[model samples]
Target: MVTINLTLNNFSELPSLLDVFGCFGNDYEYTTRGLLRRKIPPVCFICSTLMVHNGYNPHTKEGPGEINIGR
Candidate 1:
């Protein structure tokens, strides 16, 4: 498994990251305490962070967007 330390300063980059990781599956989204949350797939998270997966697909390219975690 791979881990990424992301500092999201803005919301714009959320969608882009979600798309790139193919995390749009039905079970990917959920609501917790009235706040919407997304579940990052272990494979997607690993592949995206490490930039290497045994079964990596060439079509899915790394996202060029930036996430701002600032409040």
Candidate 2:
């Protein structure tokens, strides 16, 4: 068996990482040093962090084009 390791280079890479797991199905596993032993939220950390990075604030809905992503 061969094993591969992945290091998250940036928050922007989150979407690509998600695509990898979605395509891999049961072949992938989330193996952090000691994180897998505990119970994490069902929402998943990557998606939540990405949403915040994209300025998706639940409390503020200023307008349709209000988000300043600054890209």
Candidate 3:
């Protein structure tokens, strides 16, 4: 099984839809290897979990902190 593990240190973002959309922007891509990798994307583990828990549907506004995407 493949697991995408992320860690958000010092999280302060309030969350938002745009943040989620932007997360899949230019930097991110899905590979045939069944892995999602990104570069310079604004996302963290907390936000990611929130996105997944909400079915990738975030609803908050006024995001905080600089989110860094990881594998």
Candidate 4:
């Protein structure tokens, strides 16, 4: 299994998307041993974990210390 997490420096400035798309499929490709392999992309349901900690960031303070202080 593979998991990927991404953070954008200019995330809030992103324009609204007119449409969204998602898929749960796999790609068939030959491996080094000439055997067919299925490559699947990881699916992320909730990704907005955090940007940084400490008492900083004047923008959305989504970090654990600022936002989620408890639990």
Q: How do all models score by TM-score? A: 0.20, 0.24, 0.22, 0.19
**How big is the positional error of residue 2 in model 3, measured in Å on the Cα after superposition?**
22
Per residue, candidate 4 scores C-alpha lDDT tens digits across 1-71 of 22222237534433321111112123533344544434542332355333332222334434434455668
> Which is better, 2 or 3, measured by lDDT?
3
Candidate 2 residue-wise lDDT, 1-71, digit = tens: 22335566445666675665455434334555522211222332434422332234443233435556778
Q: Which order, best to worst by lDDT?
A: 3, 1, 2, 4
lDDT of each: 0.44, 0.42, 0.44, 0.34
- Candidate 3 Cα lDDT to native: 0.44
- List the candidates ranked by TM-score, beginning with the highest: 2, 3, 1, 4
Residue 36 of model 2: what lDDT? 27
Q: State the lDDT of candidate 3 residue by residue for 1-71, as single tens digits.
A: 22232336313432442354444656665454545665434444554533432234454455644677996
Q: Is candidate 2 or candidate 3 better by TM-score?
A: 2
Q: Which stretches of candidate 4 lie above 4 Å from their native place? A: 1-26, 41-71
Candidate scoring better on TM-score of 3 and 4: 3
RMSD of each: 17.8, 14.1, 20.0, 19.0
